[model samples]
Target: MVERGEPVRLCLHIGMPKTGTSLIQSVLQGLRPQLAHEGVWLPPNNLAAHRIAVEAFAADSRLSTRADVEAIREAITFEEAVAHSRPTSEEFTKVILSSEYFQQCSVPLLLPLLEKMGFSSEATSVVAALRRQDRILVSGFNQDVKAMHRSTPLIWDPDDAHQLDWYALLTPWAETFGKDAIKVQVFDREVAKKESLTCLFLEACDVSYDEASVTSLEVSRRDQENASLPADLLAFKFVANGVTRPGEVDWLIDEAQARGVGGGVYGLAEETVQAILEHYRMSNRQVALEYLGEDGDLFDDVVTAPTHTDLTVDPVILSSLLAICVAAQPRAEGARNHHLR
Candidate 1:
């Protein structure tokens, strides 16, 4: 929120995916009404995260034409009175636009689009949360398998290793919006739980609020945003993906999330883990020095590479999981739930 006679602040929480994005989006989305009362607004893209903004921007970023910009506008702006409401420039002291894919906005389209949306560059800042590469990769792969509607088993591709390069990831944002405009937070699950991610996000944005109340605010995670399946269930779902319709498979995905059956997305040997980490070590270090003002490693948690070679679930867990799948309600083909939105 802005002070009297000061510019209204705009905070764009672009994501480096899988770094508690769901939880962050969930918390902010849950707090939208409360935040609105305080003169800080998070606009809705179909009632939750504004992921379409980045997709729209990326579309224009590709073609670099005036028509592409209009296409971007057409993609994100809803003229229907019954659709999502946006605050007028005078309505709010501060505004937050968020989407995990926003980190990918490199071209000039984003800033000009925001200008059209009534946010000036001087009042805008970019906020991001970065996860350790190895963990995010595994989690990202699990998500791709679960929701990407993979016709074949989704395997983590080596090509995606470039995604682990934090330096490369953030550089475009810095170039597009000056380095000083970027605010970075290193993702720590333990710390986030201890001090709610919502509060952490507010702290990052310099938004004022009652921390206790903000932390206490609760929302249902029924859509199971970014929930991962345990290796066994993941394997079951992966196999089923080969044979079943995407909708038919949703029942197991939903059930697995509800029961909290989650584990390592992939069993990695120590050598493999070390290889992945070592590959991106420098990129992360650059980010630490350039953005976080820290020295050495960007992440400090102890790395535990799963040592088990067997992918099979214990018989009992497998049986229970299968039974739940059998008894679970099937969604109509092509149906998807967006309870959080």
Candidate 2:
């Protein structure tokens, strides 16, 4: 399938999260100048492509009968804004959307949309990175607690046990599109680090790797403070619409240091992480064997995650987060007009 504005070449970079997706995206952003020099347009629309893909997947009854299209549509609205802001230029001809969450959608749903949009399997390249299950969950939970979100209940199991079944999310890509077209890399947070991963990913996206180093600038606006909820709070939030005052939640979250609660409190048990990993690994192992055989070991290898001390938060992340929050909230027409003035 082909898209009107999309160049003949398209790359869909899906992911196994915490695999330096943010860092990769930032680096990709820097390459926009160089990419434009090469006639490539990394449309801002893909900034939230995963959310759109997921929403689309859920909304299509053929893919997910219980799916909520409105939720997904709302998520894609941010990407739409980015698309709207793009300037018409001859330098950009191709477009790419990068996100890990896109992995959540079912292939059946994605294929039809792409076909309908004129993007065929032949014209698309899929990219994703994998990390050790053990460490991925640890960092993911830490992110959740920092944002005052809910953590998983399973926290004491083995490493590689507490995650969404990886195979369930990834295997389909290899199945739908030949494994050769699906670029899967095991992310070793230590060896390549963030910048290195960006370099590797850019190479996959058909972009230049020599242009610049990864920026500390955070561009995504998604909130990460999801820790697991206490039963009552969960019930209230999910059931009662959990109406939270804007900015109030952030202030309450800032008090974490005084409370002496470290972010680890939100992590799932080690066993749970391991279980989740093994559950998916079981299915993924089959795909690996089918695709790689003896060479499958290369794909199954683990990438060591970096230590907390090494990960730094860029202040820019705050601005981007605020932008997303404001976008999600309802604004009065007069207020929007006043701001514009």
Candidate 3:
């Protein structure tokens, strides 16, 4: 908790997406009780990452509806927490709000919201965890497919839609939150050193975990959620996506997982990977000098080459998709009849 006269520090972690965010959030949630004892509040009732709260407040066709906003009872603004943090709170010295949506948000849209919430620029900080542009693109495309957003495969046209510009993304935040208040950590580098992205995130927020109790929290590769589908099935999934309902995608994903093909499966060529990074080369350099204060590149220029350019699917999975279609035909007809009635 803050002393007799200290402003509670507010930390906003704007996720750039597809950068192990789900995994990071999972770790923080697992250690929530320990963090609470240390005066670090993640909020009770599984509100740590706070996606719904963030979605409710900032409008860019904001995700949450008015009903959702009201249902949460104004947790979007952290009303009670903000009020309690005034002068001093015997409760918490720091508050963290995180969401991938914030990364897509602009300063003009967000500044007013923060001011209304009683957090000043001086007491607030922004933390961004970045991954390689090419990696993010590939991983994100897979996620989109898994979610049944579309059936089309990723087209290799850098000009059509490009990778994220780190400089463009962070410079605004740095200018608004102060250069010192903006914390940038390379996701690839940190993952290489430590097993837990959560620990790295908390460290960026200035929360110590060395002495904390984490006997209950566990992390293993097996349990990491939102993993990309196996690379070999990319083409098969693209085809199945055309015929399957959105909800059916989960069953397909579960079957893929059961096969244990694992995620981070390569789905792009080495040349495509290089081209994607090249598109963002200069912007990344500016971010390195300005945000990270480093003279070198923002991330290591490395590419994991795809195993095969020609797409192939396991016969078993292909057969399963056929069976699913066959099984659904009667259900579809029955639903049509019901609708007609």
Candidate 4:
């Protein structure tokens, strides 16, 4: 809370990605006026806080790992835009910096930085909304593929499942922010289905939910042409560094969709979803109970949709054919650049 004469204390909302951050941020960004009226100023153009945070973390000398720097840079680039466009006001207004990548933040890198930024353990509220670990991982994999326009289905090895642990995501933030300062919530897909979850989240932020209908809850992912891979997915796995253009990736996604080469890359099987939940339950029961509360049953039900199969172009649409023809031709970059390494 800002006193009449005191500078407003910043409240950072570090996200764990894929947990509805895009929808919430989009809604808040759209309702800037409404938010300001309630003492919550959502900056319309200051959207780079994520990038700033990442760059800040990457530049920190305390952490020696290159992976940490790379991750920090990505998060900082995405978040910095949100932090720089704060609303002007005499009253204390909450300035939020949100991104989903912070789930992997290291405490040593996060703690001292928060202190340096005037966010004390008491002033900082490290917020994270967790889904069941298994589901989060699968969704993350799909999201990764979507961003790169890869058509192959992401296969999981049970041995590598530790990468998706919810506890691992939370423990660092909790340790750095202090357990009491962290407000961790478990996501209920059913509540999202009922359209009540957004309101609940806004309410937690002390913002009104009257404009929920006008606010879009659309999930952000890569364009439709980038979500799945074909049977020949390995060729695109390691594109040559400078030659692989993003447009070529979209073209590949379109071609794979046209040929119907993969199943449910965007959507996972029901059993597979359930198995993930079970795996999380077996692996991270303590973490779930600690973060989600003992009574929370949101993880019991697995959420899924049927495999998408609409890969064909409309037969009678001339414009669609023309668009495809234009897309099919190489756009300065092609197969020569396709390599992950």
Candidate number of the best TM-score? 3
Query: CA shift at 227, candidate 1, in angstroms?
Result: 2.1
Q: Tell me each candidate's TM-score.
A: 0.78, 0.60, 0.78, 0.65
Order of models, best TM-score first:
3, 1, 4, 2
Against the true structure, candidate 3 reaches a TM-score of 0.78
- The model with the greatest lDDT is 3
lDDT of 4 by residue, 99-155 (tens): 544544455666675555434565566666767665566556555544543445456
Query: Backbone clashes in each candidate structure, one number apiece?
Result: 0, 34, 0, 37
lDDT of 3 by residue, 69-141 (tens): 4444455345554443232355777777766767765676577766665567898888898888877877788
* Model 2, residue 54: C-alpha shift (Å): 3.2
For model 3, the run of ten residues with the poorest summed lDDT: 213-222
Off by over 4 Å in 4: 1-10, 43-46, 56-89, 149-153, 190-193, 212-244, 249-275, 282-284, 295-298, 301-323, 326-341
lDDT of each: 0.65, 0.52, 0.67, 0.53
Q: What is the lDDT of candidate 3?
A: 0.67
Please give, for residues 204-261, the per-residue lDDT of candidate 1 as tens digits.
Answer: 8888777766655523542535766677666666676778876676866677667876
RMSD, one per candidate, in order: 6.5, 9.7, 5.3, 7.8
